[model samples]
Target: MTFFAPRDAETSLHCPDCGTRLHIARSCREVHMYCPACRAHYPLREYIHRADEAMERFLENVYCDRIE
Candidate 1:
């Protein structure tokens, strides 16, 4: 069973390894990019500059408590 549902990145970001589109997924207190084909995870910081609407929303929820 999965706890969180991952959202597809709205940008045209491609995986470096498998050349597959990446998905924005979040764990308890963090968010990152994941490649389904390669099963590899990337740090959010690496893609923040290219974040899309979905990524923005996820970031807001993840950091809401620290915003103030």
Candidate 2:
């Protein structure tokens, strides 16, 4: 079978204001990281979404590789 999407890769999140790319960093139990684009920061929810998406793709890739 053919695979789609990046394997275990982080999603490139762009800033809404300046279009600067952002990376997710786990802060404290309360927060995540800074937005380079808007300069307005966000919470863990955003990190969770990105992390989950990356993790899912990661697992899928590992499984697919093993199967082949």
Candidate 3:
């Protein structure tokens, strides 16, 4: 099963390959951009500049867990 953070529709992040909207998804240890239509995963560093509210929320949770 895929684990994705809640998406923010106002975020305009899109897949580089298919132009589909990207979602914030996490694996066992990391979070990144995921394109459901293209089934592609992109590293956060590559898209951090374009991050929106959803990505920000996901990152906050990730770091909070690590700190505690």
1-68: candidate 2 lDDT, tens digit per residue = 98564312334566555667654443223224456556656553544445556444444434222221
Q: How displaced is residue 44 in candidate 3, in Å?
A: 0.7
TM-score of 2: 0.39
**Candidate 1 displacement at residue 49 in angstroms:** 0.6
Give TM per candidate.
Answer: 0.66, 0.39, 0.70
Task: Point out where model 3 deviates above 4 Å.
Answer: 1-11, 64-68
Tens digits of per-residue lDDT for model 3, 1-68: 97655432223698889998887776667767778888888877787777787677667656433221
Residue 25, model 2: lDDT of 43
Candidate 2: minimum summed lDDT over ten consecutive residues — where?
59-68
Off by over 4 Å in 2: 1-11, 31-33, 46-68
Write the number of the candidate with greater lDDT, choosing between 1 and 3: 1
Sort the predicted structures by lDDT, highest score first.
1, 3, 2
Instruction: State the C-alpha lDDT per candidate.
Output: 0.70, 0.46, 0.68
